[model samples]
Target: MDLVTFQNTILPIKDKLFRFALRIVGNPMEAEDVVQEVFIKMWNNRYNMAEIKNHEAWCMSVTRNLSIDKVRSKFRRETGIPEGTDWRDEGLSPHKSAELTDAVSRVRQLMETLPESQRRVMELRDIEEMSYQEIADLLELTMEQVKVYLHRARKTIRQQLIQSESYGLQ
Candidate 1:
């Protein structure tokens, strides 16, 4: 594609890519770096872009892989920063209610406790509002598999909420 086409099509997805990276890496700065790297990769591979189908899904898959790779590298090096930092608070500011903030934090914690596959699926399907076919394309899973994972992820989250309500976090 030409530069104009690339800008019009590719640049629009940067926010989505950043969000996906942030979801995986749990750090906004690192996610921004990942998105930059993804754009660089796309630019470098621009000549071959025409051969690929579903450019958005391809970009998302690349973002997912790059973000996971970054997380793995950080893990190997032992970054002391703990997970589950509330990255959302800065955006909410003083507008959103404290109860909503706490609930979001709790749900984020619950999401962290899930298996990686389930967490990724939940983030893509629910948080990103992606369709099953799009998710399957991005994750390289079958449509049925994507559905199953999303179902299980939601079920697990629901069960956890029920448990938390009934017994509290003893």
Candidate 2:
């Protein structure tokens, strides 16, 4: 794609890519860095861009991989487990912002408990609002497989939340 075409097409995806990176790396600054790096890499490899049938999927894959690498590198230099490890244990109060934040935290925790494939499917689908075809292409799964995993992940989270509610945690 030409520079102007690429800018018009890809610039709109920056927020989504940043959010995806943030979800993976759990750090805003690092996520921004990853998005910038991915965009730079995309620009440098612009010649091969035509070979990519799905540019958004390609970008998401790049962002996810880079975020994972950053997380691993940071872990290697850390002395202990990161904060928010047990973030799911925190429940949402009825207050608006706290409730939303708690719900996000709970979902993140439940996501962490899932198999990597399921978690990724859930993140890309529910969190990032990606289409099934897009998610399938990004994760290299069949569309049906993506739907199945996403369904299962949602079911699991719903059950967990229901159980928590029954226990009067909220």
Candidate 3:
């Protein structure tokens, strides 16, 4: 792709790429590095860029692979604990704020417990709000497989959430 095309198309998805990388690596700085590496790789391969049919999916797939590599190189251990959620929305009552925070944290923990493939599909479909076709293209899965994975992931999350609520963990 030309420089103008690259800037207009690839640059606009930087945050999306960062978020995808962060979802895998769980560290902001590492995610940023991964995004930079992805851009560098894309630039280096610019000659073949025109052959790509879906640049966004291509970029996301690269980000996912690189982030997974970074995590694997570190022995799959988390780099650090995430910062605590800030319950600073002035519109919310203190009790409501606490409830929202707790709910979000609980769901995040539940998501982390999922298998890698399911978690990835869930993140792309639900968190990223990507369509099944886009997710399938990125993950190298069929469209039907993406739908199945999403359904199973959501079901697992729902069941776990119900159990947690029944146990007063929520």
lDDT of 2 by residue, 16-63 (tens): 998888777877777889999999999999998999888887888999
- At residue 9, give the lDDT of candidate 3: 86
Q: What is the C-alpha RMSD of each candidate to the true structure, in Å?
A: 2.6, 4.5, 4.9
- Residue 36 miss distance in model 3 (angstroms): 0.3
Model 1 weakest lDDT span, ten residues long: 84-93
Over 4 Å off, model 3: 76-100
| Winning model by lDDT | 1
Against the true structure, whose TM-score is highest?
1
- Candidate 1 is scored at a TM of 0.85
Clashes of each: 0, 0, 0
Please give the lDDT score at residue 105 for candidate 2: 64
Q: Where does model 2 exceed 4 Å of error?
A: 79-82, 85-105
TM-score of each: 0.85, 0.76, 0.79
* Candidate 3 lDDT tens digits, 64-148: 8999899898765644445663322433578876777778867877888888888899999877899888888889999998888
Over 1-170, each residue of candidate 1 has an lDDT whose tens digit, in order, gives 77899899999999999999988888888899999999899989999998988888888999999998999999999973576566765545475746575667788789989988888999988879999988888888999989898899999999999998888762
